[model samples]
Target: MTGQSLLLIDGFNLLSRAHFATSYNRTDDQLKNSKGMYTNALRVFYQKIFNLIRDHRITHLSVVWDVKRDETARRKKYPFYKATRFELPEPLIHQYETCKAASDAIGIHQISLSPYEADDLMGALSKKWSGGDCYIYSNDHDLFQLLSETTSQIIAGKQGEYVYSLSHFQADYGIAPEQWVDVKALLGDSSDNIPGCPGIGEKSALPLIQHYGSLERIYENIEQLEPGLSRLKKKLIQGKETALLSRELSQITCDIAELDPLLMDDLKVSIRKDVLGEWLEQMELKIRIDSYGA
Candidate 1:
């Protein structure tokens, strides 16, 4: 919570958001260089990361990306986890390597772990290395659970930036930041294919979590819950097993091994304009390269 600020970007989340935003734009052809690499997502990603560093006076930064879908541990735990999700477009997939190279060229620390998603890596990195103020750049509400006294998640949008600090979380969700996983467990996250107790929702689950502190405590004291809620009590009792499993699916793991020593050394933001210019030129991102020295 002291000294310099560390900014972590959820690389896949940001890139996907950018790619989709530009995909339907009829005027722009998703920016391509002479090599035919899809440059739209990478351009947006780099621009946004640079803007964040400059705007926030970031001293340390890292971009974490998700590995292959089939390799994720969550998928192993529940075969249906993100099973319904569509595959990323081939063009976007093609840009993944270039994006990593661009990040390195611009002197950004980048980490991609096999069998783990960016959220889990970001969680682990923030917990282990964020000795100062830490800001997570992503649009995923799932990352809200990572909020702490020194850590917050941000989304930059047309309407302005949305920051999920501990206070903002409390005001918006009526529960402590730490209770986010429990809330998600009760309502389920369709985006990630986690099915909460059938027909149960935030309205039904929030009050119980608020009163009992957790899903575990709520189940323990279910019998003592008010008598007027007989139907609700029955639903909770019936959905007990699923709710517990959902809780496990909702939580983000933070026990990842430390990043590579070389990447750790690269965490400081320092740009070599010439090296970056060569990368931008190869990628056909002349516009970005032209603006670099400006």
Candidate 2:
């Protein structure tokens, strides 16, 4: 087992959290530089990244960002997916490029696939580099599916950070982590606007998927199940199509070929005091400039 762990961060998730945490609205929360460029998002983002590296003793880091939502394959397959999400703040949108640049300058590996969501990239990368022991940082429950012997997830909870390892995932769900996609397919994800099987939820779905292994298997042995779950069987039969489609939507694509190994090698975090201080000064964050350290 490698002592080194690669940290994969969900860039948009953290960016939005930082953006909202700092300011309530676009008008009043804007932290501008002398040239009036919005710097609040990047400032908070850098500090968070710095803390993660310092606290975790992480050396390899990758920041995976979501491309435009409309450009994603999921949106094309399901038009109503994520339709309930509010529009991103314009100020936050404006600062995205700068934030990416700041991260790049900080020497962290940054990845963004034009039409794929960051979750997919993270999943693919995690699987690709599992031998190195990968830890993904995201609050999105959908990512729980990616947990494995060599991969885990760190979630920010109200109390503190929660680390979900493969064993922990199995114990919590009573099934392997990979089965999470099937569970979500049956229960649906309200946040992503995925309409799963009607009336099926964690209570009902977890056990069903755990028993059958997958949606296909469940349907194949439908006759065997109706005797035990007569009422739920009816709902399952009724929502079979929805369940199948939801599975496709809930599953993160791991076939993505986004990260080049050589490029990923270049992403090792190395703090350059001069560049770090320059960026902080530019953002008018002089007070926090010294935190990155030499």
lDDT of the structure predicted as candidate 2: 0.80
| Candidate 2: 10-residue stretch with minimal lDDT | 285-294
Compared with the true structure, what per-residue lDDT tens digits does model 1 show for residues 16-113? 88777777653345456666568877777777777777777787888888988889988987899989899888767867877887777677788888
Question: Model 2 off-target regions past 4 Å?
Answer: 25-35, 226-228, 258-263, 286-294
**Candidate 2 lDDT score at position 220:** 91
lDDT of 1 at 203: 76
- Candidate 1 stretches with Cα past 4 Å from truth are 25-30, 227-230, 258-266, 286-294
Candidate 1 residue 75 Cα shift, in angstroms, is 1.0
Clashing residue pairs in candidate 2 are: none
Give me the displacement of residue 180 in model 2, in angstroms: 0.5
- Number of clashing residue pairs in every model? 0, 0
List the global CA lDDT of all models: 0.78, 0.80
TM-scores of the models, in the order given: 0.90, 0.91
TM-score result, candidate 2: 0.91
